[model samples]
Target: SHYFPEMRALLNECQFNNCLHINEPGCAIKKALEEGRIHAERYISYWNILDSFDEKY
Candidate 1:
Protein backbone atom coordinates (compact mmCIF):
# COMPACT_ATOMS: atom_id res chain seq x y z
CA SER A 1 0.00 0.00 0.00
CA HIS A 2 3.03 2.21 -0.16
CA TYR A 3 1.90 3.86 -3.34
CA PHE A 4 -1.85 3.84 -2.70
CA PRO A 5 -1.85 6.75 -0.31
CA GLU A 6 -0.04 9.04 -2.67
CA MET A 7 -2.00 7.54 -5.53
CA ARG A 8 -5.30 8.09 -3.79
CA ALA A 9 -4.28 11.60 -3.03
CA LEU A 10 -3.54 12.05 -6.70
CA LEU A 11 -6.87 10.57 -7.71
CA ASN A 12 -8.64 12.68 -5.16
CA GLU A 13 -6.93 15.66 -6.66
CA CYS A 14 -8.05 14.56 -10.12
CA GLN A 15 -11.17 15.98 -11.79
CA PHE A 16 -12.87 12.60 -11.66
CA ASN A 17 -12.99 9.53 -9.39
CA ASN A 18 -13.60 6.88 -12.06
CA CYS A 19 -10.03 7.10 -13.18
CA LEU A 20 -8.48 3.88 -14.45
CA HIS A 21 -5.07 5.51 -14.73
CA ILE A 22 -4.96 4.53 -18.37
CA ASN A 23 -4.67 7.09 -21.17
CA GLU A 24 -7.13 9.29 -19.35
CA PRO A 25 -6.21 12.92 -19.17
CA GLY A 26 -4.77 14.26 -15.92
CA CYS A 27 -4.22 10.69 -14.75
CA ALA A 28 -1.61 10.43 -12.03
CA ILE A 29 -0.78 6.86 -12.90
CA LYS A 30 0.00 7.86 -16.49
CA LYS A 31 2.18 10.62 -15.14
CA ALA A 32 3.97 8.05 -13.04
CA LEU A 33 4.55 6.01 -16.18
CA GLU A 34 5.97 9.01 -18.01
CA GLU A 35 8.31 9.56 -15.09
CA GLY A 36 9.41 5.88 -15.21
CA ARG A 37 7.90 5.28 -11.79
CA ILE A 38 5.84 2.33 -13.04
CA HIS A 39 6.02 -0.09 -15.95
CA ALA A 40 2.74 -0.23 -17.85
CA GLU A 41 3.61 -2.99 -20.30
CA ARG A 42 5.05 -5.21 -17.56
CA TYR A 43 1.99 -4.76 -15.40
CA ILE A 44 -0.28 -5.59 -18.31
CA SER A 45 1.72 -8.75 -19.08
CA TYR A 46 1.63 -9.80 -15.46
CA TRP A 47 -2.11 -9.29 -15.28
CA ASN A 48 -2.60 -11.12 -18.54
CA ILE A 49 -0.78 -14.19 -17.17
CA LEU A 50 -2.66 -14.01 -13.90
CA ASP A 51 -5.94 -13.78 -15.75
CA SER A 52 -5.06 -16.75 -17.93
CA PHE A 53 -4.84 -18.99 -14.84
CA ASP A 54 -8.54 -18.51 -14.22
CA GLU A 55 -9.35 -20.58 -17.33
CA LYS A 56 -7.12 -23.50 -16.26
CA TYR A 57 -9.07 -24.12 -13.08
Candidate 2:
Protein backbone atom coordinates (compact mmCIF):
# COMPACT_ATOMS: atom_id res chain seq x y z
CA SER A 1 0.00 0.00 0.00
CA HIS A 2 1.05 3.55 -0.70
CA TYR A 3 1.58 6.08 2.05
CA PHE A 4 -0.68 9.13 2.20
CA PRO A 5 0.52 12.32 0.52
CA GLU A 6 0.69 14.08 3.86
CA MET A 7 2.70 11.21 5.25
CA ARG A 8 5.19 11.30 2.36
CA ALA A 9 5.46 15.04 2.76
CA LEU A 10 6.14 14.63 6.43
CA LEU A 11 8.82 12.04 5.69
CA ASN A 12 10.45 14.36 3.20
CA GLU A 13 10.92 16.83 6.04
CA CYS A 14 13.13 14.53 8.06
CA GLN A 15 16.21 16.19 9.52
CA PHE A 16 18.65 13.89 7.72
CA ASN A 17 19.08 13.09 4.04
CA ASN A 18 19.74 9.34 4.49
CA CYS A 19 16.47 8.65 6.22
CA LEU A 20 15.28 5.25 5.00
CA HIS A 21 12.10 5.37 7.06
CA ILE A 22 13.84 2.80 9.30
CA ASN A 23 15.54 2.89 12.69
CA GLU A 24 18.10 5.44 11.52
CA PRO A 25 18.55 8.52 13.67
CA GLY A 26 16.20 11.41 12.99
CA CYS A 27 14.00 9.18 10.85
CA ALA A 28 10.55 10.54 10.18
CA ILE A 29 9.29 7.00 9.69
CA LYS A 30 10.45 6.06 13.16
CA LYS A 31 8.68 9.11 14.56
CA ALA A 32 5.60 8.15 12.65
CA LEU A 33 5.82 4.70 14.18
CA GLU A 34 5.94 6.15 17.67
CA GLU A 35 2.86 8.24 16.93
CA GLY A 36 0.90 5.22 15.58
CA ARG A 37 1.09 6.36 12.00
CA ILE A 38 3.09 3.29 10.90
CA HIS A 39 3.17 -0.33 12.05
CA ALA A 40 6.18 -1.90 13.79
CA GLU A 41 6.16 -5.21 11.91
CA ARG A 42 5.81 -3.55 8.55
CA TYR A 43 8.70 -1.26 9.29
CA ILE A 44 11.02 -4.05 10.39
CA SER A 45 9.90 -6.27 7.57
CA TYR A 46 10.86 -3.64 5.04
CA TRP A 47 14.50 -3.84 6.09
CA ASN A 48 14.37 -7.58 6.61
CA ILE A 49 14.45 -8.06 2.88
CA LEU A 50 18.15 -7.28 2.97
CA ASP A 51 18.63 -10.03 5.52
CA SER A 52 16.74 -12.40 3.29
CA PHE A 53 19.13 -11.66 0.45
CA ASP A 54 22.08 -12.09 2.75
CA GLU A 55 20.86 -15.52 3.75
CA LYS A 56 20.68 -16.53 0.09
CA TYR A 57 24.28 -15.50 -0.40
| Per-prediction backbone clash count | 0, 0
Q: Write the per-residue lDDT of candidate 1 for residues 1-57, one digit (tens) a residue.
A: 124443544566455578656456887756766787656675465446646776787
Q: Write the per-residue lDDT of candidate 2 for residues 1-52, one digit (tens) a residue.
A: 1244434656666778766665577777678779887666766665687568
Query: Which stretches in model 1 have alpha-carbon errors above 4 Å?
Result: 1-10, 45-57
lDDT of 2 at 57: 100
Candidate achieving the largest lDDT? 2
Instruction: State the RMSD for candidate 2.
Output: 3.8
Off by over 4 Å in 2: 1-10, 53-57
